[model samples]
Structures are given as structure tokens and as C-alpha cells.
Target: MESSSNSKAKPRSEVLKIMEGLAQELYAQIERGEEPVLEIPSRTLSNTVWDPKRRIVVLGPDKLKRRLLDMKESKRFMQTILMLKLIVSSIREGVYPTIRDLYYNGKHTITFRVPNVGAVRENTWDEQAESNAAIEDLEVGLNVLREEMGLSADVKGKVVGPIVVRSKGFEIDATRMGDTALGLPPNPDELDIVKIEASYVLVVEKDAIFQRLNREGYWNRENAILITARGMPDRATRKFVRRLNEDYKLPVYVLTDSDPYGYYIYSVYKSGSIKLSYESERLATPDAKFIGVTTSDIINYKISSDYVIAANERDIKRAEELVRYPWFQSEAWQKEINLFLKMKKKVEIEALSTHGLKFLHDYLLEKIHSGKWIE
Candidate 1:
């Protein structure tokens, strides 16, 4: 099985050599008048296999080759070439550019030639999504992630807790670092842990929850580290959480709103997304438990119906799909999902505010203390 690659990346020289070699091979193929083809793993569920025990989604060996000569592959071929050149240039210059930076860097080159009109500039991706797809293609083609290719994205997560990190050669305690926990740098592949007095780590799905906990000094009282992805987690935040769990052997628990999207967020932390399944094992927090604000919580807490939202067709569809996932095939998870299906209602973490703002704070503490959580 293809396990995930950790953030403790190989030396830049070594990674650069691999990327350069790929570029050279493509160059040699063109020199010989042969159409260059890039073989990348297909990013589909049919091409992915899940390891339930490991809680990781790994890629299969089946590969899809993008050839330059095909009409369908023409745009992708151009995208591949542009991204590959950028990767090589970035590596040669020893600069790690984020996905956004690369999109802008190559935005000008997004031109197509017309038979009568020379080169016509076309507006291709209004955002970085296209650039990201090209990056992933390179990942599967080279059997290395974009990060391993020495590329990263702007950090989009935060942490607030009583843990000290020796990052970039400085000892900083996250707890005493004001309201916002030290924001992780864009490139956290080299973060070194110094000291952690926390008993466990709590990964909140939203920033509001993290801020509330910080305001109440929950971390101080519980002796736990608090982290939030602010929504769906980015690679850096996931890697950082995995590091804390693996390095410190601290129990990691996730808290998310009791909704399909929220559950998916928890799943992203527990098991990496299928889009980036190649790096699942390294980034996924397999041991992290879900200390949820489940549908059951509404009844358990005696929350009023006004606080609950009726599940729409879209919500039900998503929930149904989630239940069929291999990782979610558990007695506890099935029960929770069934409850949602039967009641046709979902609850957000904020619903706890209905009881009282402090109710959520106390509820989380109670669950953690009593060991009430689902896998």
C-alpha cells in the first residue's frame, strides 16, 4: 500500500533532483519527437482503497496517462507543462511558493494560439482550483505530493493552548501568546516541538469554538491544547496535529457541529480526503476520537426544537452517503447516523448556546472526563 509522506521532508537537494529528472525525461522525449505522456493515479473512489484499521485512504497502482497529442489532453497537457516548469524553477531558486503564488506566476502564460490570430490570451482559472488540480497531477505522476515537490499553501489554521514549540529556533508558548494562538507559518515542514504540558489536544472545527474555549481558559483548566482549522483543515494544520499526536503521544479528540459537513471535517482529520489519498497515513489522525455535538446531544442536553434545524434533502443525501463509507461503518457511527435519518434534524455546536453559552464548555469537559466519545 502507498502510505502517506510525512512533513519531515527529505532534504531540498534530494527532492529537487527528483523533479529535475522528471523534467529532463520529458525534454528528452520531445527531443526524440515522441509525444510526452504523464502517468498519474486516477483520483476516483474506484481507484482508491481504504484501510479501516489504519484509518487511511491509499491510492491503487492503476494509472491514467495524459498524452500531449490528444485533443482532450491538450489543455491538461499545457497545464502539466506550466506547473512542472514552475516546480523546477522554484526548486532551482530554493523558494517554496504556495498554490496561490503559482497560479499568479503562471496566470500570464495561460494563452492559446489561434490559427489566424497568433497567441490569444484566455482567462483560465479565476481561482487557484485549476492550479491545485495541476499540482495534484504532478503529485500522482511523480509519485510524490506537492509538498514533497517543495510546494505549500498559505496556512489557514490556528492553535491556542499551553504547548511550547521550538519553531524556527525560538521557544514560544502558545498559551500566553495573546488571543490568537501563534499562527502556523505557510511552510511548517520544519516545526520542532519543544515542550507540551497539555494532557491531550482538542481540535475544534470552527474558530468560534476555539475562541470561546480560549476566552474561558478551558485549556488552562483541562491542561489540553486547543486547535481549530476554522473549517475544513488545510495540509499544514493536519500535519501539525498529526505531529503532536505522534510525537507527544497525546490523545487527540475532535469537536464539530453535528452536521454532514462537520462530520466530513472530522473525517478529514481522522482519515485524509480522497483527493489527497496519497498522503493519507501521514496526515490523518487515525487515533483522534470524535467528541461530538451529535444529534443525540440535543436530547441529552434537553435543547429546545428551536435550536435544531430540519435536515434538508441535500443534508439527508450527504448523511446517507457518509454512512456507506468504509471508515464510518461502525456500530456507534451507524447509530448516530440512523438517529439523524429518523429525526430528520441536525444540530450545530452553537446549539449548545441555547441551554447557555457555558453549557458547551461544561459539556465538552464532561464528555472528555467521562470518556464519552465515538470513533
Candidate 2:
């Protein structure tokens, strides 16, 4: 049975001790490139960079003394001993651990004596080994995920600060004084944003397109600088886009593909998560507009044989439903939907030739800069 005093029972002081160990373990896990669990009372205590004083107060000194005393001198029956754990992370302002080599790579294989209730000596090793095994598995999984995602660049380089209490769930962090994420895009109308006379900004989903534009020198040098969503658009991306208007006073043009997946991506960027709609709606990038690969484009531009890739039944159903959705019910969307029902095809941005896309690039640049594209 779960404790009735779950929320209230968690003292602030106990929250600190649980988090300090959690911070150590989480640091170990991330060093191995794993997703560390950030549960409370840790999130409550050490979420935003570690302050040994204020945050750690989640567990009071008295509460920790009681818990520690219960573990130490109580050879007697003190039946209830639940341990709270945390994984505290400090971005740049953390003391780097002096990693001691494991016995059999002991730094990786953590073996410690955890004193729990109803044990012969002080505790049990059976559950200890199992829990330690879980950490090992998590570490290995993180390593594999990094390699698979080609995120070695990020995993090795990305710095985390301290986790703080936001109204929503988790953010990067702020435990120490000076450990902020440098890559964080500025708030709208903040500094470092350059104003462009061009009206439109092209936001792409992949790095390849942005890299290609720079390498090929295809984009309007002064009109549009490319922005990559880095896969999915997040708070960071939305912040950046919101700024193009409020900061740089530029209109936006989003260009992706005519695929069902790309349609969903544009929808999410415009209106936020479809499933988590209520919670995520506010996070949506309200400043951008969609501009390519409509259903009509798929049919008019699509080659039936090559464009008709085997879309899953789910995707087909989603495409149909998307057409009916109020947001995409405009004439441009309706025409696209009708064509989709007929050909059931998709069009990729790649399908647009260098010459063809260059024309679009020029058209979009002209429209944006001329103030004709602003809604």
C-alpha cells in the first residue's frame, strides 16, 4: 500500500539528502550518456542548479537526522524505512567528480551497502544488485541511443545547469551561478537579433537543408537566413520564431514537404501538440505561416509512381482527418485534401529541383521583403 502522507510526508530536509545522492548518480548516468530520472523530492530540492542551502530545505535537518539514525543505531525494529532518491545536475558550476576506477570498472559498476528494513546484517544485497543492474542497463541504453541518433555531438557537448520548478514539467537546469545553456535562443525582441528588411524567414526541419543553403550560397544573402528545427520544434525554436517578428520585425515562411508527416510537423509548430493540445497550445509558435507542398502540389508536382510511397493506414487516416480539422480547412488546404484523396501521394522538398526550389526561394524572398506576404 502507498503511504497516505506521500505529498506532506516528504519533508524538505529528507528531500535534500535524497537529491545529493541522486545528483551523484545522475551525474554518473549522464556521463555515460543516459537519460536521468528527475523525480521529486529531487525536482523539488535540486532541480534548478544545486543550492546547498535553499533547495535542500525540502528535507529538514531534523528529518534527515531521524532517517539516518533509524538506519544507523536501530538494530531494533523500526519497520518503516523508505528511501527517497534524486539525480541532481549542475551545468558548468558543478564540482567534477574524481572518478575512481571500478573494481571491475567500479566507476561504472556501483556497489554500495544500502541498509533497508528486515535484513539479516544491516540490509539486503539481492535488491541492491538488481537496482544497481538497472542503472548499468540505463547507462548502456543511453550510449546506444546517442550513437543511433547521431547525437554524439550534442551528448558530448551539451551542458546541463540545474533543474528548476516551472509550471510545466522539466527544463535544462540552474543549480549553480553561471551554468546557463548558451544555445538558448533569445526571448522575442531581446538582444543579438539582427533586423532584416526581408519579410520572410524560412524554417526547415533538417540540418541538411540549412547546411546545403550555406554551402551552395542559394538563400537571399540579406533577406532570409535559414533556421533548422533540429527535428521537432521545441520551446527554443518557438522562442526564436516569435522573435523574427517581435525582435527583427520579419514575417515567416515554413517550408517542409507534402508528406503526411510533414503536414503534422507544420500543424504542431503552428498549433502545438495535437494530443497534449490543452497543455501545449500556448507553447505553439503562433507567429509562423505554412508555405509549401499542399495536397494540390502533391498531385500537380507528384509523379504517381515515385511519390506514392506506402503510407501506413494510420497515416492515411490522419491525412483525411487533418483535412477536416478546422485549422487546415482553408481553400488551399481543401484543394490539397481533395487531391490527396485521389492520388494518395506525397511530395518531398527534395523533389523540388535545385532550379525549381531556387525559383520558390526567390519568390518567397520577394513576397516577404515586399510586405505582400505578411498576414
- Compared with the true structure, all predictions reach lDDT values of 0.81, 0.42
Deviating ranges (above 4 Å) for candidate 1: 1-7, 27-37, 66-78, 94-96, 107-130, 148-152, 354-357
lDDT of 2 by residue, 1-375 (tens): 111121111222343344455457657866987644432111112222312222111221221111213445232112111111111221122322111111112212223455773433433223444333323222222221111111112211111121121212323232222422224421211223222344346766655665565445434354454566655665445544554544444556666666667777776666554433321222345556676655565444444555445556776898888776545655766766667767676666666563365655554455355543221
Model 1 earns a TM-score of 0.84
Residue 343, candidate 1: how far off, in angstroms? 1.1
Q: Model 2, stretches more than 4 Å misplaced?
A: 1-198, 246-249, 278-282, 299-312, 324-326, 354-375
Q: In model 1, where is the ten-residue run with the lowest total lDDT?
A: 1-10
Q: lDDT by residue for model 1 over 340-367, one digit each (tens)?
A: 8899888888888877768887889888
Cα lDDT of candidate 2 equals 0.42
TM for every model, in the order presented, reads 0.84, 0.47
